[model samples]
Target: MIPIRSAGPADVPVILSLVRELAAFEREPDAVTATEAMLADALFATPPAAEALIAERDGEVAGFALFFHNFSTWTGRRGLYLEDLYVTPAARGAGVGTALLRHLAGIAVDRGCARFEWSVLDWNADAIAFYRAMGAVGMEEWTVQRVDGAALTRLAGR
Candidate 1:
């Protein structure tokens, strides 16, 4: 059986390693630059920027879901954005993903979040179907935008 719980400092190394595995599965192995110390700072430091829930099976980290809360002024409500979710292939098909998602939903409900959202690559049909199966509606009307590197710096300094 998969055991789920909020991650603490002792789980940091496992979390970082699983993050690397997730990046590799996405075909972007070089993308994960988050160091263990950096994660400790951002995730466990005072005034935490985000929170994570981890899935473990037999004491091994099987998967994780990282998320943060967002505010919606127009709706006058808060939203929970699932930033990253990954279950090792060896751990898939064993209810890990479903458990993680359901756990997130419980938190959203407890916090009175208006919505729970996440983005999946268009090529990842399996995840899309899994999400749909879980009663998630496709947000086709929304377009995601981002700025990074120098662009982010310029925008922040403006």
Candidate 2:
């Protein structure tokens, strides 16, 4: 059985390593610019921007899930947004990912969240199938928009 627990400041290094591993798995190894100190600050600050859950199997880290809360006007309730979920390469087929997701789902229900959601890359067929198997539907009609870096600064008239 895999045990799931909340991550703390002491887990910053391990969390960052898993984050890098996830980036590499997603074919974006250089995308993770966050450092350990950044993670510690973000996750262990007075009011954390996010929370993380770590899964351990046989006393070894197997996977992790990073998430935060959001508001759902439609439901008039808060929602849980999963930012990232990753299982070690060796633990992919061993149910680590599913376990992590299930754990988060429990948290969502416990907190009275209107929903739990996350986005998966369009090219990640395996993840798509897995999420579908777990009863998650794709929001095909919704398009995601982003503003970042210089574009964000310019838009803000900075």
**Winning model by lDDT:** 2
Where does candidate 1 stray beyond 4 Å?
Answer: none
Maximum-TM-score candidate:
2
Question: lDDT (CA) for every model shown?
Answer: 0.91, 0.94
**Residue lDDT tens for model 1, 29-147:** 99998999998887898899889899987787789999999988977999999999999888889899999999999999999999899999888999999999999998899989999
Off by over 4 Å in 2: none
TM-score of 1: 0.94
lDDT of 2 by residue, 1-158 (tens): 68999997788899999999999988999999999999998898989999999999888889899999999889999999999999998888988998999999999999999999999999999999999999999999998899999999999999
| Residue pairs with backbone atoms closer than 3 Å in model 2 (clashes) | none
Cα-lDDT of candidate 1: 0.91
